[model samples]
Target: MFSDSTITENETRRDLPAHLEQLLRTICFRIRVQGREALKNYSITAAQFDLLQRVYFNGPQTMTKLSQSLGIAKSTTSGLVTRLVRDGFLDRRRDETDRRVFTVAITPLGEQVIKSVIEMRVRYVEEVIKQIPEEKITLVHNALDILYEVMSPKQH
Candidate 1:
């Protein structure tokens, strides 16, 4: 039951206990921390890693797009982009068709980090998953896949 325990389970989807939601959020945060630790020698922050991921997967982005995607202010995005540019991890160039607009692209160095970060994170998760029973692992994998598909926003 939720919403002061008055809402009936039949009123909506299965009752989602608040703790389960918090647990999922906590797991996500912990995994990101593990990734940050894996990147200790790269001198990059978690924010930078996340931004690099978004750009790497989605391609070059305008400052406005970056800010909106990263859920940060344009000024803050500027600082992050400036730092990445200074460190040779990202490049900023003016759009040829629209001189007033600027776009940011990940550099080779950034690409390398993206691969390493992904591999490192995958390996970390693998190590943890190995602890689970083989049969249960399959169930967990399938369940998580379903959960992701159900919870993720619809693609454009």
Candidate 2:
């Protein structure tokens, strides 16, 4: 099990917010620990999986869209996309309306891999949370909704 003892180390509770750091670490740790092996099955890393998921669910997208979705730089997303394209997980094409613009979509193989990964995730969640009551599931959703709202970026 992952230890969270360091979350209580800082007692200033003033200049620096310990809870925020702890929250970030805990979330990262959980994803790394829980999703590590699951990712290996698809020959992907966590970052790769995140990118692929964004594409699978919300693409055919421009590099800008992927950068924004992944919270990384456009250059970084471009590199990731390049590697994916090389691996045949995605295809890039110029937009007909604007030849200068490029977009990407999951290839058939990518779709199949993503589909399998999704099913694995669904089964994992069901098995892990099966003991929780339906009412608690609603509570979890409500809590996440609040968290999402709080963490949402401010629009310019």
Regions of candidate 1 where Cα sits further than 4 Å from its true position? 1-15, 153-156
Instruction: State how far residue 85 of model 1 sits from its true place (Å).
Output: 0.8
Candidate 2: tens digits of C-alpha lDDT, residues 84-111 = 8888888999977889999888899778
RMSD of each: 4.2, 6.5
- Cand. 2 TM to true fold: 0.59
Task: For each candidate in the order shown, give its overall lDDT on alpha carbons.
Answer: 0.86, 0.76
Query: For residues 37-108, what per-residue lDDT tens digits would candidate 1 score against the true structure?
Result: 667778898788888888999999898999999999999998988999999999999998899999999999
lDDT of 1 at 152: 100
**Among all candidates shown, the one with the greatest TM-score:** 1
Clashes of 1: 0
- Say which candidate scores most in lDDT: 1
Candidate 2: how many backbone clashes?
0
Q: What lDDT score is found at residue 3 in candidate 1?
A: 70
